[model samples]
Target: MVSVRDDATMREALTAGQSGALADAYDLYAAAVYGIAVRITNDHGAAEDVTQEVFVELWQRPERYDPGQAPLRGWLCMIARRRAIDWRRRQVTRDRYTLLLAGQALPAPNVEEDVEASTMAKLVRAAVHDLPPLYREAIALAYFYGLTYREVAVQLGIPEGTAKYRLRTGLRRIGDSMSSVRAE
Candidate 1:
């Protein structure tokens, strides 16, 4: 909802390729973008990198943003969120690969037990990740965020019973998935 007059200077900077304009935009919007990154990444260093990446992209591809389409801060926050999510995914994959290598390099004393434990952990993670979005959101709020059912309902703007139901259903699905692994 930025009026043309409000964004005239920014539009000019983006079009004319003015350095100071980019700097001014960075100073104004960097903190908001960084806050979103930190919320998602939960790592200040990664958030900092994400924030820097956002501004660099803005500077490099100013034409990608349309002031008429959305506010600059909102567009930047959306980009920050996607980047932070991508970073977290890459980190998870890297960590898993590193662990695999380390496991091969140093075998545990009880190979059977270690393998079983690792397999169960993977199964549990997969079960949670594969949950439908509705149940997954409730599970994340109630369990990961440590919100009580009532608090989760309030956070998600749903009734308490609905929140509890989602949590129960999600956990039941996970348990069903894990039951086979337990038997094995």
Candidate 2:
């Protein structure tokens, strides 16, 4: 067993895949990584996920960590920060898509709330709910669950081409409804 105080030895053991090195690293660094993730993501669940990803990356690609460029702790923290930011961004996108399709008002990022935009949001939500079950299921699978087209197809027992078509046609119908509203 390498001395835990010697980070260099621990890293060398880690690169060599020696047993206990990873555990030592987790003992020394997991708390710091988890702390950074929680601060950036503002969610404990997301923070735990991010922490796991960071450790996995470290274990899978220890060579990526250049001890000369930065310390092991610094590299781990950097990875955690980036992962937490990505997690937060995905959540924001999911929330935005969910709001638009779940009968909620759209949130303007930097501009004042426009009444016209709000009305269009309602129109889109109504159009989505009015869609036939086939298209509605496709939308829910893709947007609500964040599944890829292939995954959606697999989940719904449909061909990938059919899933793509349903997503496109469903969106097109919503567009058509909005277009008609604007025309009137």
Candidate 3:
């Protein structure tokens, strides 16, 4: 297994396309990458894809590594996080207006208030319940499920943009509703 600290050497090996070095790196960091991806994406398959993409990207852009700054793992994980976020954001954009254009009404919400928490939790749950279906899905997947936008998109089979949009709109709506509930 390769030591993650010797990023300078790793960068050199990667730039030279040394398969052994890459394999060593994979052996050293695959678990770390997968753990982070799984935490961010909350889906095994999507996390696996993100993990694969990170390595592929590292190989394609080996020169991007800078030993003067963070370690190789840091750079790799950053790329994974960004890619995952981008994936979900694209999904959000694609699905944003689809149902509206179809002239279909928003589905009835099935959110249940959490009785265990305080009134704020209950109100928050109520607000989430009132959100549109897509928004609710996005919010739940992103927050409750601990998934990045990319993983959410993969799980939902939607564009990343659409997933992002849902999260944004859902949060805004929930905030507004919760404020109103609190004010009353």
Best by lDDT: 2
Candidate 1, residue 149: how far the Cα is off, in Å: 27
lDDT of 1 at 162: 93
Candidate 2 lDDT over 91-164, as tens digits, reads 99999999989999985565446676787789888888989999988887665444557766876789999999
Candidate 2 worst ten-residue window by lDDT:
1-10
Worst 10 residues of 1 by lDDT: 1-10
lDDT of each: 0.79, 0.81, 0.75
Per-model TM-score versus the true fold: 0.54, 0.57, 0.52
- For all candidates, what are the clash counts? 0, 0, 20
TM-score of 2: 0.57
Q: What is the per-residue lDDT of model 1 for residues 1-184, given as tens digits with 9 covering 90 to 100?
A: 2232355558558667888877888877788788889998999999999999999998888888886654566677778989999999999778778988878543346888989889878998899999999998888765554456876676677999999899999999999878866787
Model 3: per-residue lDDT, tens digit, 83-167? 7776666655556567678887655544554433566787888898888888887787666545678766765789999888778
- Candidate 2 colliding pairs, count: 0
